[model samples]
Target: MGEEENISVVVATPLVRSQVVTLALLFLAGIVNFLDRSALSIANGPIRQQLHLSATSMGALLSAFSLAYGFAQLPIGPLLDRAGAQRMLGAGLALWSTATALTGAVLGIRSFLALRVLLGLGEAPFFPASLRIVREEFVPQQRGRAIATINISTTLGQGIAPPLLTLLLLRAGWRAMFAMIGGVGLLLAAAWLLLLRRESSVRTPPAPLAETFAGWAALFRVPAIWGLMLGFGGVNYTSWFFIAWLPAYLQTSRGISIKTSGWLAALPFLAGSLGMLLSGVLADRRVRGGAVVARVHRSQVIVGMVLSALSTLLAIRAASLAVAMACICGALLFIHFAGTSAWGYVQAASPRALVATVGSIQNFGSFMIASAAPLLTGWILDRTHAFAGSFLLCAVVALCGAASYILLVKDSLPLSEA
Candidate 1:
């Protein structure tokens, strides 16, 4: 059978109960993953005050996590392909949770920075592993919706973090907040390992090291991979900017209280969750109707990125808080629409055996670009005392990402090649 025919044959099988359970666990794990990442941002003000750090220092502290996370992706991708998601994800959850918990005890910038780096290392395997699971469990036509379902945890965690972490920061303080969140993650890790014990034992045998290296070299030669890398970088540049700075921006720039900022900051992420859901449904429907998978997903990504750029520019220009919030919501909605479609694009564009490797490489490039967002925004705020420049930069990057997808990433990758 041809590649498309093989995919159809896989899709024709009924969805099994184990797949549902696996997806549920993956979703839960994703929520905790983001919650840990966002904790520092939600408590940015308190941490800086307590540690006596400047905005630039705080920005460096934030960037430490992404820098480590991005670099770790290079190795973690190959590890996931060899070791399987069940083992890798469980181990990652445990390591990151320990790092998160240890942050509560740090005395200064250096120690906190170290813990953040560790946290990033621990979290690096998450998306690559999760995407691999989706690829293994679902066929091509169903992967978009499956991936979207997994991606929803990102926005949900972001949406919930502000209010939840704010309450924790207020009631128990930031240290206690980190400790508690880390404790919850540890529990989840144990649960994951136990639950997936059977599934973990059934992985494919490890590929020869030389053959694996050859596969990586071949993937690097594909032109579309470069487009994916740059395009994803644009998406992460905007997404991580909001993830790392939105709460603090509301308080400092808009003169809103932390409590109110916490609530307000959630609006955009909530909208983002909806956007991802919509994109998934739309992509699947079009593909099921005999639309070309790459064309459908790429068009969704391009349109979303363009709209996201426009909305971001408008958001920064809004005169009133309500107007700004509405515009920000619109921006996130479109940005996340692109984000989901981008992952779908990754799924459609990768060889089956190298799905996690491609995802990790894409994530590595994106985060390498994104790691700059927090630092740059912090530097701009310290110098100019405004977010206008930062927002404008994000809008420009989004447009560039749209152009990358439009001009490159033309079709599905060759299935015959690894």
Candidate 2:
């Protein structure tokens, strides 16, 4: 072969293997994204000490990220509508990954807060885009499995973050830990850029910003969507609380060592993953059986929320570590149950053409308030030195989340062509 022929053969190798399938790359990207978000929870102890942050300051830092995350949804949906998920997601991945690496360099709470805000902005498009992918690629009956499978990556990533970071923190320290997360992100993002195709994000006539805003406004008119969002927000509070403060709680409240804390903290998420899978599978069954779309969604979310609330309450009172882990897992399973329903609402509620817009708004509303849960829980912990109040509050909010979906949105909305 000619010299050029040899080079062409090597170049073709990437086409053959460097780029994998679309769904596989997207899944890995989601995994890396969650890993970055959950890393803070894993490194909470060291970061708190290194910066001398108070509960409120720490809470503020956590809240800052949510603020960006929540608010970004307001506009990102429309942007995705115009630009498409593939490009938007690729850009977001690069932005957030770099921010994760930069987090290791902050010397004070201010810079850390800034970094988190930026991180939130970068990460905001991830779930929306993922949901878009599921909606576009999977058939109606298949979406639950696809969403659940993608959600699995979230739990798996979060489950892995603590144990993995715990190992890194012990050897290289927390700065190195953040840097390592950045490296993982780079690899994932490269995979995404190389492998993922544009089939899902193909563009056409744009949804006018005025009408997009108007479509979002329709959410306000419908008490059901509002209630669903409120309930979803409540669920977020509990989940994020676990992500942000569980380690600190274990270290201070339970007197568990960091190593054991990593293991313990991971347990619930593992359970949550199972719950996620079960809920999706069950939901698919319901849809296949000809259950009303809204009712199936309601049933799934309600089951999860009720389970989560009870499990959380049990977790608070449990005397033994094994009991607590068990309780937490039960709650996690319930939590995942609501998760599929919540996304299902987004899929069902939105105008088909503007599915991304509706989904984004659903998430934006929920996360806007949900984003505060971590910081709010942190503040409560710092003041009272216990998670009981925060967890209880979260429980109440979760109940509200269930009620919103069950009572408010049970009557379906009339769909308009986008």
Candidate 3:
């Protein structure tokens, strides 16, 4: 072949083959990650019956995982930057998977709570590591789709977990369900190691202690980071509310059967998956249209958050179950539409070197706020014996998130310079 032909072939080879392989592995890993975490939520009713726990106590149990996950984010960024995503993620998958399996052995609330904490610690590296990998593998222009693609695994896991696990729970029991999900995670971990053997990030030498501290300090100096953090925090409140409580809500509040509730609860997350994919496409087109990266991202987030808030309010006031599900689905769709842009904003704002750090910081703040959702919702339900107030709280938080994107995070300059 001629020189130009030869060059084209070489350019095309690594981009397609390696990128696809890496993303596939990461995507599958993400699905398994969420499946394991969501198992408890799926089986919440059964577990509560067996353990004789109240909503307040169950909320605490759920918070155990989130608290640990949120706290782990504080240190996970530096660990990813120093150790690279490959080892960190592989080890995390193995550890969390093992924790998930062992959850089947828990004899009481205390042991289950401890296992949940372990699960959080093990899974903490996932998103930060994934973000770092995406930054390394994809070009800036393509990053939105790449981010969205991996994120869809989240919705898939959430969407599938309810019905699938409910079936497992009905047939085999919750313990068996945990063991099965955990085994899937372990298999995925091994696959992740094998599939990416040729794919590893070059580990940079650790910075001096003072410099490392300063880098983290610099992150806090950026107002956009804080804005993104707060904005996304509100988004998480909406998401975690559904993730943690939807099945129970349908079963108790809507008077739906557990089996049907499982299927119905999956609808919102399925819609979210679609929204994520569409948002990524729209974000890329906006960038191609000469919009600044920050503006493109913030615009999507602001619009989605506002619509999500409105939809959430409508869901609360929805006249019937069908109407309510439709409204809730719309809310989730818009939340995820903004969710895609939220990560895109993080990537666009941070320099390549600090993608993991920025992502972890965002995760930390988001989870910290999200951690409260289940507990607060439980508390609200206990007090009011209703979901109207709980759904309203989600709407208000989402509106705040929209305001943060519009007013606090300026789109003019990248976060590195801010």
83 Cα displacement, candidate 2 (Å): 2.1
Which candidate's lDDT is highest?
1
lDDT of 3 by residue, 289-352 (tens): 6666766777899999999999999988788999999999999999999988888877676655
**Pairs clashing within candidate 1:** none
lDDT (C-alpha) at residue 13 in model 3? 22
| Predictions: Cα RMSD each | 2.4, 8.7, 4.9
What does candidate 2's lDDT look like per residue over 290-408, in tens digits?
A: 66555676678887898798888888888977887788778777887788677875665555556676667777888877877887787788789888898788778777777777776
Clashes of each: 0, 1, 0
Question: What is the descending lDDT order?
Answer: 1, 3, 2
Query: CA lDDT, every prediction?
Result: 0.85, 0.74, 0.83
Best by TM-score: 1
* Cα deviation of 221, candidate 2, in Å: 2.8
For TM-score, candidate 2 versus 3, the one ahead is: 3
Which portions of model 2 miss their true places by more than 4 Å?
Answer: 1-20, 201-218, 415-418
